[model samples]
Target: MLAAMAATEQQNRTWSQIDVPDQSGRVVVITGANTGIGYHTAAVLAYSGAHVVLAVRNLEKGNEALSRIVAAAGHGAREVHVTLQALDLTSLDSVRAAADALRNAYSGIDLLINNAGVMLTPKQVTADGFELQFGTNHLGHFALTGLLLDRLLPVRGSRVVTVSSLGHRMRAGIHFDDLQWERRYDRAAAYGQSKLANLLFTYELQRRLAAADASTIAAAAHPGGSNTELMRNLPAIVRPVATLLGPVLFQSAAMGALPTLRAATDPAVEGGQYYGPDGFMEQRGHPKLVRSSAQSHDEDLQRRLWTVSEELTGVRFGV
Candidate 1:
């Protein structure tokens, strides 16, 4: 019984709590920064003095977020510069183009936040014919991360933070042969698979970085239950259920971002750590370390996924 309790406690403290000093000279790229938790994260980072690049799908929405950030920053707005860049995760071409533009503009990226994702979205195909959720949430970020890895590695203390979710636990596992679900499609199942992939990628990338003796750190975070636009596509039937119990089960967007913010800025954070809210059901609260399933740490699946992603995107990341 004591051993069981100790094991549980150890899992809970995977990421230490420590203050992250100012990020005056840091450059950060965040996806889906137009609204919800993404916007709050960008705003907070900008307020804290990081040069934030908002990688949004809609230019107009991106501009709005920039304005909001500027307004929120007040006189210190000069310390935080928000650059709006177009990034449609569903399109490989768009991802490649945005990466190119970012590389041309910034010599090194201190942080890359793979935050943009769709949740419980309707079954649809992306521009490259991949499932929408998998395309945007997993493959898109994979390609972008690989593309920007060189710039990231050059920086002395760079980090790539990938946002995942508790939905991952619902996934059976990655269906490697039929990743796109050509034969069938289940919205929640697909979303869960993608979230699980995010964790696997985070762990696998950390391993790869260790092997290459790189200075960069790779980590993952889940917002708990932040009630973001991620659930916009949930079937109408589910919204009523969510509304009836959302307050009891979900946290505000600002609170939802704490785990992510912690992962990005915490000085004590190391590669492969995962963070989430420390609440009764992980539905909301302060940032704390979290545990993922044994499947998420599988080395074989990570390698296979990385290889397949490069082939599908036609853009190698190590470049």
Candidate 2:
């Protein structure tokens, strides 16, 4: 029992940027690829010879990121093929349209990285009328995955990798009764709940895929304290302090993206596993397989959330 109860230790084995396998001939779609961790993830994979689709809400910014990624790839840029797709996670219509566009463009997608998110924002609703954090972070990705699952299903070893966060460790769980927080609001708590939802979605997805005997798998990863624009919504009072401490507390966006890259491409990865940094408190270091909160592993909760998500988005997976 004690052995079973022990926290999963960081593997002594190391994984780094160079460890990512050649992605030649692979097709990857990464949301929020215009900047920060998403941009870095797209860049690295492009450098490794994957055709990366930069899914962003803003085409102008997406084009800029494409240029930057191509330039960063240097001579490898000739081998890199990166394109831009407009994806607004705040809107279901946009999610559907983007998925349709991707389907028309690619016969198979090797990886779909649900990496876009909003954090710690003031109370607001998405274009779909759901609370912003929960809507954009969870439901949007849920719908996107469902719409794209068919494309992934036929591809051997294809994966849907959702980028969750260490923030999920906060006092959080699925607020089933108050999912939208229509009665009350706490930005931090809402953010925690959304991140938690990311895990639940991944676990439930993997289960359904397995039960259906599908080749596609679901996994998740966290950036773990990367200094990025995602923090723009931090409370005004806390912003200055975070800014001052950011340099000391955060890793580069490139390093922060390692866990995601591993989760997306690692040959050893299994469905439903979560990956994050191996450093203290699971922050600021190389990627390693990590554990999530017990709530995240609750199969009943996962199924319930999956059902609620399908109801809300009106999108059902083929699995």
Candidate 3:
């Protein structure tokens, strides 16, 4: 709630743009902004007077979200600019096209939030033939961020915010042996690996940026248990229990977006920092600096994943 934050700010306090410094001239690009946490993140940043770009795979849904965000921004009645960019993270061609369009348009970018992702899903692969969850959630974002790093490196205080998940800690590790689940596929584990990749990417990118003495930084955040479309792919057996506990355990998407907003906008945030809900088990509450799993901090795995990502996507970040 205050501009100056302690190691972990007040357990219950949340940061709305009301407490954040003005974002009038900033350019914020957010992926998966059509619904859920991404939509809320765009709305709040629009309310803060930033030029918010809602990057979505579906332009129609993006337009609808644009309308809602405009209304939300109207509550503050700030002259805000909210637009959409076509992006399908499942396709590398799409990632390159989107990155090119952004580069041609903006001279510098302030924030690039890799917020879109898929959760549990049946065995599937991307247009590139990688597992659906891993390809879209991790690889797609990996390529986009790398392609856009040049746009951010020169901007002071610019940040790349990647959203991970609590499920990353549950039976999750980078399965280099079967990276795409070509041999065996478990929906939960596949989702876990993708989420874990998000953190690994964030930390590794931050390291590279620091090594190059670049102005940009990388941070990660998790929404905890938020009521969003991500769970639509949950198995039938677990749906009923999740439904029963949803009201008690899940926070609204707006509340869930706080950790991301904090990580993206907080003045105190540093490279490789993580933010998440402050409630029990990080399920729901206002956000605060949070700890990730030990595996997420493994340097060797981080470097390996980065190398493999570059090889797979063919997009290199010369940090």
- Best-performing candidate as measured by TM-score: 3
Q: Model 1 clash pairs?
A: 146-317
Displacement of the residue 206 alpha carbon in candidate 3, Å = 0.6
lDDT of 2 at 67: 91
By TM-score, how accurate is candidate 3? 0.96
> Model 1 lDDT vs. the true structure?
0.87
lDDT of candidates 1 onward, in order: 0.87, 0.92, 0.92
Candidate 1 vs candidate 2: the TM-score winner is 2
lDDT of 1 by residue, 1-319 (tens): 9977865664456332234458788999999999998998888888777999999999998998899889877773456778999999999999999999999999999999999999887779999999998999999999999999989999987999999999888855898879998888988889889999999888889998988889899999999988888767878988899999999888889888878888899876789999998888788788888888888888898888878877888877563
lDDT of 2 by residue, 1-319 (tens): 5543432332446788798899999999999999999999999999888999999999999999999887776772456899999999999999999999999999999999999999998999999899999999999999999999999999999999999999887878889999999999988999999999999999999999999999889999999999899888878898889889887678999999999999998887889999999888887899998999998999999999999999999998898
| TM-score of each model, paired residue for residue | 0.92, 0.95, 0.96
**Which is the winner by lDDT between candidate 1 and candidate 2?**
2
For model 2, what is the C-alpha lDDT against the true structure?
Answer: 0.92
Candidate 1 lDDT for residue 147? 91
lDDT value for model 3: 0.92
